[model samples]
Target: PYHSVAACAGLLRAGGFTELADGAQWKLARGGKYFVSKGGSEIMAFIVGGRFCQPGVESGLSIVGAHTDSPCLRLRPNSKVSGAGMLQVGIQTYGGGLWHTWFDRPLGLAGKVVVREAAPGRPDETRLAEKLVRITDPLMILPNLAIHLQSAEERKAFAVNPETHLQPVLCSKMFDDEAGKEASRPEDAGDARHHAALLEVVAKRLGCAPGDIMDADLCLMDSMPACLAGLYEEFISSPRIDNLLSTWAAVQGLCDFAASSAVADCQDVCIAVSFDHEECGSQSTCGADSNSMSVWLESLLGALEVPPLARPLVYAKSFLLSADCAHGVHPNYAAKHQSEHRPDFHKGIVIKTNANQRYATTALTSALFREVCKKADVPVQDFVVRNDSPCGTTIGPIVSSKLGIRTIDIGAPQWAMHSCRETCASSDARHLRALCGAFFESFRNIDTAAAKM
Candidate 1:
């Protein structure tokens, strides 16, 4: 479960994308690829249209979006707490997840840490540092209450209090000597000395003084790495599969298109954007609700020397594919899904729809995606929640409304959505990559067809 935004930036850089700073002037080449990040969590990448500089033909944008965030336990600023002669780390749940599943799992910490950097002549400045600290030797566990101690009713209805039951015990009585030593350091006074041992471990790993650590946005993730599961090894069992799968698929698709000669000869710009905080509402500056995409588009057009009046025409012709994870019908709980609309694993990509606009897929846009899948020889499925069940949303509708561009919501089907571990078919992941590649390669023809209709 790799969750760091800085990590995503590294991958994009390796994929031949030149990073652009805010308000930086850049020249766009025919078939040029570039990317920009907001708060290092949300990222957007673009490929210039091959025919963008042609005389009279208008170029359209083919954009794909996914999110990189997942539900996990985040440590607070003052996270150290001692109880029952044991040192524990205080944690707050970040998003809605299967909390009980997190119990008794080998967890590791990963996220960016903010540190104070002081140079000789310059003023003190704060910088962000990232690290993936693994305490995988089973350092902490939220032990479950014994079943023998619970009533029959209580046993049937399992509940966990995040404030009380979720704290992870790191060690017992071993930190006393470290705490005493920390007390002698001037910067480690008061509550800071409480978790001196833990800070010392992190400081050592980061190669920084303990006092330079200002704060962190650390999250506890399952220590287990992604691997194939099932009798025939047909399923992928991993953490953050709900969205990281989509992010990976989108990146693979864009890279495939960029390497193809067909894409280099085309006139449509292709993009893949992965945002953070979609697990929570996307209200941050880097979120879909923000003007990050819009501003970037305008800048690109300006660099291409497109007239201001022609920008709206370019947007009107643009299309966005919002890829996220879709729920697969569980074998044991098939009845929980809509009777006729249950999406199955390994079948194909799922097209999500909601009349209430929870999903942005309309008849035209959904058909556009289906046509793309058909061209790629990929199977397609449909998913709509049961009438009695509440619908979940994605960045589809948010980006659609924000840019007023035609959009469709789609994803690879998966099981155990918010669990510490989730399941999906490896075949479906491959199919999504092909589908997105076909979309980026053939979107120009699709746009012309849709325009005629």
Candidate 2:
């Protein structure tokens, strides 16, 4: 999930959006397409509309927001664990994941790895570099205990203790057999902290000596690629679909808007934000809870030379669609859903609401979004947690409170949400993109239509 920045940044750059460094001064202009990244995981892209900079222009940003991270198992520091001739990797569960789904599944390794650089530089000092590594091959597996091995109570509950049952087997532990296969030199010796077999696999992927891998931040993932499923291929069976679907859809909409002629006459800034750390909490520099967007906005406003007084108006006028995917009503456990507010697959966008402020949606925002969807001819639905159930949250409330941006929580329904593998209606992603793109293209006009209200 942390790999999202590279994919999104590449997409933006390919779409003619210039990348801006956070540390550098920004000189934004009307009708410009640009993006900025922070903490290597969070990204924001924008198309500064032609209508920007007019002294009294009422239009503001049409923004879509989603998160990049999801629930998964992360490799702990010093992850090596061996018993009974098998080497296993110690794992730490991240977020509230369905740990049971992870058992007996093929797992791949991915994330940032720190490697050594040229021994001598500037001051002839040894340097290091971080590289993203993803080994697509099925490198590990957490096999479940067989039915015969389980106690009667365990068989019924199938309760998984993450600490006890989550360790994934990497390979056979033939410690003596590896002695001669490993590099012996001080510089050539790989990170002893990790199992030798694991180091060898990663080093092989990087085409470097195992010892070159100094440190790493890796997680286990389903090695299977996402694919179309169902009799008519109407379902998207995949991993990380919960938020990645929203993240991808938002960026695609932004890029489509940037490419279209609408930007030439558009009256508002069009921005797509994919923040990190939402699954856990958005408190990081890259998270929506922080000043990432504010900092970027301040820089842009300063560069565009908007009047100090009008800056507030521009912010006040902005509307943000918080687009984290919602849960679809389960077929087998349909009773668990709110009877009056069940969201079905492929039923279009779900406008999630909560009385306790779990979501940031308000009556006015919901009305505005509904109007936009209606004009665009897109279907819409609503969802609310059962009174007896606790409502889940998204980046909506955080961004709304922090930036004072008008926000509404929205998502396309999906099933098996935090599982190692998940499912979503294939067409729902298309609808989501269409709705977001329509919102970007039509927000200014919609605002005009509702001016009297």
Candidate 3:
């Protein structure tokens, strides 16, 4: 679990969504609002439609899928690496991050630590507890090498080697005595692999003894707050803007729709799922590649007592809007984008297409989403990769393939993806939210019309 996972939980609870346990028997009610996930990093919320719950009536799902992960440096076990009286923590690049951008920046460590509790009768058996930890006050830094030390080629474009250059400095050896005394540790052999100062900070944050923390899934986070930039604050300068913005848009869209009068007329189940591990291959248990969606959907319909034979019909009627982020044409690197299909910021949501099936978008899905945007009065854009460039993929293809749902890939336009920081138009987020809301409210009716043709 990370900071965003906790905040997401709070937001869903505040939005009047009840949580369901993934392993327990579901007792869902008609027009009920619910969320379910097995881990902290994953969340899926849904509102059952009253109209669809009627006996013998067919309905489907309108899902908006986004990812909760971003590229960053994750701490490794036995991270303690020290030399010349200065301590540094070893880190492995978690995803395809711009290695150079992380240099010389203030960094915070935040993630879940598995705390161990002694079992009374068994020394080898311990109960594990997870505590979310954050050392957010710039306690670490990955300073860049001085420019004078760079080669001519490096000076022109900074390049970084992840193994040697990315480990962040934590503290000096001077704190070894003082912080170590305060953070009492076990005499276990593996305990020496962690820096005392690092453990001290995590211990203080969680108000637990340092020795209790057996293992951690810590990562380096940029210690910068997202802010408005550009003339009149037209742009949002932030970290994790690529997918976080889309996650927010999906949740906000659902909340806004649930509060509006149109919700009562919605005939399909509306859902928003923010999955983890998308930055990687999304193969984890909570990832979109997993059977999480299919399992939960089947369970929900089973709980609703939908006939086994009619379950396939519900899947056919479902649709998914795979919301990620679109690469806006960068002013300095405009040639990298397809000339006629480059998306711009604040213009609206971008419909992404790839001939190689990198995206799940089809003519049918695009037409439906376009009408949704039109009904919402939100502008829309399109994105296509250049013929010579390789296209990035999203959860759309995987989920659409698994569930056979009519799916389209879409996003808010952004710049500098996979960097320490990124930028995007402020209005694009609002447009995305509006489009999502309209899609949830109108997708069923629109799909019905499309089917008639």
* TM-scores for the candidates: 0.93, 0.95, 0.94
Candidate 3 lDDT by residue in tens digits, 87-149: 889898987999789888899888988887767788988898877887768888988888899
* Most accurate candidate by TM-score: 2
CA lDDT, candidate 1, residue 114? 67
- Lowest lDDT 10-mer window, candidate 1? 130-139
Candidate 1 per-residue lDDT over residues 274-343, each given as its tens digit: 8888888888787788888888888888898888988787888889999999999999999999999999
- After aligning candidate 2 to the native by TM-score, how far in Å is the CA of 45 from where it should be? 0.4
lDDT (CA) per prediction: 0.82, 0.87, 0.86
Give me the candidate number with maximum lDDT: 2
Ranking of all predicted structures according to lDDT, beginning with the best and ending with the worst = 2, 3, 1
Sort the candidates on TM-score, descending order. 2, 3, 1
What's the CA RMSD for each of the models?
2.5, 2.1, 2.6
Give the per-residue Cα lDDT of candidate 3 at 168. 87
What lDDT is reached at residue 280 by model 3?
A: 91
